[model samples]
Target: RFPRNVQLCVLSFLLPSDLAAFASTCKRLVSLCRRDQRLWFSMCHRRWGSQTLINKWGSGRISYRRLYRILDEYKNLIGFWRRCGDSAAPASSSPPPVFFEWGPSYIAGSRVFPSKNKGYDAMIEKPFLWMSVAWNRKAMNYLDSDGKFVLNEEDLIGESGFVENELIRVNVGKNKITYN
Candidate 1:
């Protein structure tokens, strides 16, 4: 095994999934990855893109792992919602509670195709974090890097608002999403 610095440099090239798999193979690798915030930061910058971190996270002292996890959660949740359908529509002409199965979702180029995933139900059980939206109308897209969220205009606006490039910030906790 190389020194910690060399280990970190080597580990930096691994994707999050690859890193996790490598870390699981031994305690030394796990400790090296977890204890060094710089490694995680490098991973964050690599996966999410640098400007994305600057725009969304700024220079604040935030955990890279936490940021990555929350972003993953958002992607999963949006995928679930998109698959479930018509978020603006009422649950059944009545309101009490509504629930549905999970779905698959993906972004290809600038477009997002909605589908189903059974794992969505699991997302609801996780704690709420925070979300940020970068609304780009000319490009017709909505983005949240931390939550791994991206929605095209049709999914979010449904042909109504004057689409413009703007950033919307919201905090999701205490069972609510509040603008900041």
Candidate 2:
């Protein structure tokens, strides 16, 4: 029951501190307890500004992966809603987006291993927002906050998908692992 004209800057991310104490006052949106820039922009800014807001939201205190996931999901949702609402939209506007482009497919060869000193967790923790697939002789490894190491795609491996870009958080061991 909010007026569409509500000012954008006042719709805070509900940050506990000063930025916009008023944002925290919203009773229903308590789900997004953090100061998410996307919510703010959606309430106030135009669609084109979404990318900038997403980048800003990511660079803040939250982990890059979480922010990236939120932003990525937001983008997908926006596209979905737009298309669903306007079935007659131009075909060019409704094409599938290539989020990732692997050589032929997501194969084991495009995988990286964990170093002895720095276990798998150490690298995954780093800010690795997956986008525009790039070619690399060395594939990437993901070590989640837990000690578990996931070096392969989850599609075939199932729940074994490595922690998404948060690997450096664990201690790696010198165990050689390879699959044919």
On lDDT, the candidate that comes out on top is: 1
Please give the TM-score that candidate 2 achieves against the real structure.
0.20
- Per-residue alpha-carbon lDDT of candidate 1 for residues 1-180, written as tens digits (9 for 90 to 100): 568778877887887789889999999778777767878766666755533442234223346666555445444443222224456767654322222211111122122222346454432222122233222211112233243343343543322121223324344443444555
> In lDDT terms, how accurate is model 2?
0.33
Q: Quote the positional error of residue 128 for candidate 2 in Å.
A: 17
User: Residue 85, candidate 2: how far off, in angstroms?
Assistant: 61
Clashes of each: 8, 17
- Candidate 1 TM-score, C-alpha based: 0.40
TM-score of each candidate structure, all chains considered together? 0.40, 0.20
- The segments of candidate 2 whose C-alpha lies over 4 angstroms from its true place after superposition are 1-8, 12-16, 19-26, 32-37, 40-180
Off by over 4 Å in 1: 54-59, 74-130, 133-180
Query: Candidate 1: global Cα-lDDT?
Result: 0.44
Each model's RMSD to truth, in Å?
A: 12.5, 18.9
Model 1 shows how many backbone clashes?
8
